[model samples]
Structure formats: structure tokens, C-alpha cells
Target: MGRWDPDARGRLERAALELFAEQGFADTTVPQITERAGLTTRTFFRYFADKREVLFSGEEELRERFIEIIRTAPADLTPVQLIRHGLEAAAETIFQPLLEYLRTWRAIVGSDGALRERALRKQELTIEAVLTVLRERGTDEPAAEMIAKLSNLVLQTAVGRWVAQPVAERPLVAFVEEVFEQLRSTVAGEPVHR
Candidate 1:
């Protein structure tokens, strides 16, 4: 079994998703999540602090996982390249189930303003965490943060579309690379000063 289990996290995650879907994230309670998970309220509290936290339950774990992967990545890789490599490794541990949760996450977030804000907050924190790792590896702050934010965007877009794609043929890493290429092309059209 992977260090992170789809089954165990899924239990809590799915419980939260259902309650948020049915009763709303704001309306749901911690007790209800425990009840749905067939676990204790203390257990629920052990894993999550409140109903809103369920959406972010895995964020820290996966962020640290990816950061470790990046820190240990080979020396010669470029920042974008290393991020890509780290993402591939992290995907094995991170992406698949997150895609599953995002479907429900998207629905709930779309319906509620507070949930949307929370989701944005989580994304910002994730980008900040990634940037911190990059800085530790000696990357400059602004560039590292920009790339991290862009990488995150690719992951979210890919995961959101992966299951919904007509062919379901593109790899997630490929999607990130594709996005980078598109952005590169967009920038290429700008007039050069030098």
C-alpha cells in the first residue's frame, strides 16, 4: 500500500464531500463527518478540524511530498524541468485521488462563495509552500513563485480535465508541458526591447 491510502483518506474525504454537497460546507458539522465515516468525533478531529478543512485535508501532505521530491531532484535540471520531474513523482502519490475529490470540490465551491474563497486560499498556500521549497534550493523568490503558481495551474487544469476528456489520452505531465509551451508562445509575440 502507498504511504497515503486512497481508502482511509477517501473515507473521510467522501464523508465530507457528501455532507457538503447535501447540507453545504457551512451547514455541515464535524460530528456529521465522523458519523458518516463510522468513526469517532475525536477521530474526525484527529484528521480534520472542521468541515471546511476536509477539502484541504491532503494539501499539506502532498505539498511536502512534492517538495521533498524536488529537493532531491538531480542537480542539472532547470527550475521548470525539476518541477516537472517532481510533479511526476508526486503524481504517483498525489494526483489521482485529488482528481476524484475535485469533482465534488468543484460542485460545492461553485455553489458557495465561502467555499470558493477557501479553495483559493488553499491554492495560495500551496503555491507559497512550493515557493518556499524552491527558495530553499537557492531559487530566486519572484521567479520561483511564478513558476510554482504556473505549475499548480497546470496540475489543476489537467486533473480537472483528465477524466472529462473525450480521448482521455494526454498525460498530466504532458499537459503541464503543453501549458508552458503555450505561455511561451504567447510571450514570444511581445516586442523585444533589447
Candidate 2:
């Protein structure tokens, strides 16, 4: 592969994840990632600000997708239903194909305090974006905030389970629906089915 090769960003991401997994996040460097990808240091910088950006570069796009999902959801849906709809859509469209990448990214982020904090910050920004969209759609502030937080929980839990499951055992959307069902059961004072 050369710098002009297709999927330079994808190559860099894969190379970074491999290096991070083998050498640890703190031990990985831009030159090593670029070398592993058969890309130049300049090509790596073209796609990311730093090595960390390789892991988190999709967050802004994800936030935008979430906002779009909320903005376009059916007006008749209750707050919880609207959130569920958005989360399921995101799971199918944004996360389902990235299970392996996300599992690797999650492990690398978890091993480093700063990376974990960065991931949390990105999640918070996404939640804030969803909250704003919900409020714009006329949900009350308190309800919007709660729904935003709950949606994050559902997304994280669903993605966690989806990544942990054997490939083809279940779709990410199923996990999202399951978590929502559990949330509904908990709120209704019914026994959650685990």
C-alpha cells in the first residue's frame, strides 16, 4: 500500500488499533502507525490530528446522525419512544458494522485514564447534541435531559453486549431494543427479564 492507496483513513485506523493493542496506547506512536499502514506520516496527519483522533474521529459524524434521527422521528412518539427510535436507528446505521473496531477501541480507551476521559467527554458532547435536538422538537428541558442520558445508557449497554456476543449471534439493534425493554420494565416496577 502506498500513500495514494484507497482507504487511507481505514488503513490508518486499522494500523493504529493493531499497534495500540500490541504495544499499548501510551507506547504507540504516529510513525509506528503510519509505517504499519504503509502510509506516510503526512497521510496520517491528513486524516487525524493525532493518534488519539484515529480512535475517536467518527464521534462528530455520530452526533450529527443522532440529531438527524431525532429531528426526523415521528411527531406522535412519546419521549421514550422517540429516544428508542433514534438509538435503534443509530445501532443499525452507525455501530453495527463497527463492532470489531469498537471492541478494540474500547479496550484501548479503557486501559488509559486520559483516553477514557476523552471518550466520556465525547459521549457527553453527543448527549448534549441529542438533548438540544429533543428540546428543539418541543420536549421539556428536564425530560429532554433525562431522555438524553437514558439514550446514552441504552447505546453503551447495547454496544457493549453486541461487541461481546459471537458474530452473527445478534444484531446491535436487538441489543438496543432489549435494553429499552429493560428500561421500560424498570420504570414500570416490573421484573426485568435480565
Candidate 3:
């Protein structure tokens, strides 16, 4: 393969996911992934540290975008509101295009214990990224951390529903908003257990 293969990273990511799904993550190998992607193992290592990293290749970009959008969000919005805005931007730019991938990714990660742990680490990274932006916006440390974590909770809940439905049912942004509202009501002492 040429050294300058375009989108080698994406190809590797797709290949890795396919292999992980077909053979199970524990059974998949770096050489197998590289072979599936039609690239050398050297090219695979250039894009990712390992097979696990392939599933999370988008997180770094998503983190940066979340931080950027949150930082530039309207100054008057509360930290939670800012987070919602950031998540809205993410839904439009990040999650929307990858809804199907999100479902598959969730299943792949959930199916493996190690992957689930790594996925939690990714979630922590996302929370830290959000807190960074919120703190830069002058939110108190506790408030920033709380808002960031809460925002992630709402996002997680909403995304679960979002990917299960047909895209035509509702946009991810709308699902996020509805989930946040439900979260607010539940936290306000509304009987949510029923």
C-alpha cells in the first residue's frame, strides 16, 4: 500500500469494528485488522495505538469540539445550559452522522469487559473536557464538575433512546432536550420511579 493512503484511519477504524464484531474483540488481532483495512501494520500503528483505540478515535475530536463550542457559548447561559448548547453542537456535527455507528459501537463496547472499562475512561475524559470549558467560563469548580457529569448523564440517556428510534422519529437534539427536561423534573422531586 502507498504511504499516503487517504483516510487510512477511517478505513482502519471500520475494519477494526468489523473484525471485533465478527470474531469478538478478544479474538481480533492487529494483523487481522490491518489486513482487513488493506494497509500495513505499520500504517495501523501510525493511526492508533491498538485495536481498542480504533473504537474511540473520534473522542479526541469530539472533546475538542465540545470544549470549543462550550467556551464560545453565550456568556449569560448557566453552566448546565452551556453544556446543553455544547451537546447540541455535538449532536448536529458529531452524533447525527454516526447514529448507526453509535449503536454498533455501544454494543461492541458493552459486549467486552475491557472495552467497557475503556469506554468509562472515555466518558471521564469527556467530563473533564466539559469541566475545563466550564471552569474557563468562570464557573466554580464544584458547579463545573457537577454540570459536566450531569450533562453526560443526560446525554447518555438520550443517546440510548435516539439510536433505538428511526432518525425520522426525532432529531438527537430534540431527544437531548426532552431527556434533560425529564432529568430536571426527576431531580426536582417529581416521582420518577413510577
Candidate 4:
């Protein structure tokens, strides 16, 4: 056990992201992160297993929250509607206040192969969590898998566009809803895209 600082973990994550963006992930180190965070290396380790974990933290919490949201959603929602509601819940919970972090994270994670792999693994885990929720709702087989994949795509596309596009006055959830609606329309044969 190490020192307990209420803000230590967030500070370490902020410091790590800043360092990773400035010096590149391959060149940044734990000491540098701790130093920048104004915390001891032991404090950093108390919060994160390693420097890489800094970039990948919160994933478990996010997954748990997302699954819980799905599980508690209204029982009458269609499978697609359930996924959409899950996306909306995620938007409210995970992606809303993370805009700046999303930008920095895109740069850092996109620039590093290892980080990208970790991100993909996180996606896989999220999909699995969604699948578990869908299965518990009595969804089965290819339908559940397909809905899970589609939901992931909607999430990825929304987040990607949200981060890659310019800063806008609109909320992130609005963008997610817009993208999801467009996807739904496209799938319905109305083709929002030309």
C-alpha cells in the first residue's frame, strides 16, 4: 500500500497523457509521469500497474457501468433500441466530459502500435460485456453478436468523428445520437450517405 491522495490517480492520468502527447508514448517513463503529476512513483504504481495502464485505465469501470445500464434499460426496447440506449447511456457516462482527453488520447493512442492494440482489446472486452447483457435479455446467436458488433461500430464511428472533427458547440451525445440515427436510417434503406 502507498500514500492515498484523493486526486492522485486523475493527476497521474493527466500527467501521463500530457507526457505521452509531448514526448511520444515510446519515450515517456513512469518517473517522468510521477514527476509531472507531483506524485511519487509508488503513488503512481498504487493507481496504475504501469505506464501503459495509465492510457488504458477506466476501461473496467466504463464496461461495468455500460453493462449495468444495458441490464437496467426498459424491457420493451427492441434489440437495436437497447443498443442505442446503451450508446446514449455511454455518451452520458463516459464520453461527455472527455472531449479534450479524447483528442489527446486519439493522438497518443493512434500514434503508437501498442496503444492501438490495447485500444482494440478494450473494444473486444466492451463488445463481450454487451454480448453478455444481450444474452441475459434472451437475445441469442448471430443476432446478439451482430447487434453487439453494430453497437460497437456506432460507438467507434461516433467517438472517432467526435475526436477527429473540429470543436463544436454541440454536445458529444448529440453527435453520437446523430450518427446512430444516420446508421439506423442507412440500415433501413434510406441511405443517409450518397
lDDT of each: 0.73, 0.88, 0.85, 0.86
RMSD of 2: 2.1
On lDDT, who's better, 1 or 4?
4
User: Which ranking of candidates, highest lDDT first?
Assistant: 2, 4, 3, 1
Clashing pairs for predicted structure model 1, backbone only: none
Error of 3 at 173 (Å): 1.3
- Per-residue lDDT of candidate 2, residues 15-101 (tens digit): 999999999999999999999988899888888999989889987887897789889999989988898889888888888887788
How well is each residue in 1-194 modelled by candidate 4, as lDDT tens digits?
25567888899999999999999999999999999988898888778898999988887987898889999999889888888888888888878888888889889999988889999999999999889888998887789999899889998888887777775567768877898888877878884444
lDDT of 4 at 12: 93
Q: What is the lDDT of residue 2 in candidate 4?
A: 55
TM of each candidate vs. truth: 0.75, 0.90, 0.92, 0.90
TM-score of model 3 (CA atoms):
0.92
- By TM-score, the best candidate is 3
RMSD of each: 5.5, 2.1, 1.7, 2.1
Using alpha carbons, what is the TM-score of model 4? 0.90
lDDT score for residue 52 of model 1: 73
Best by lDDT: 2
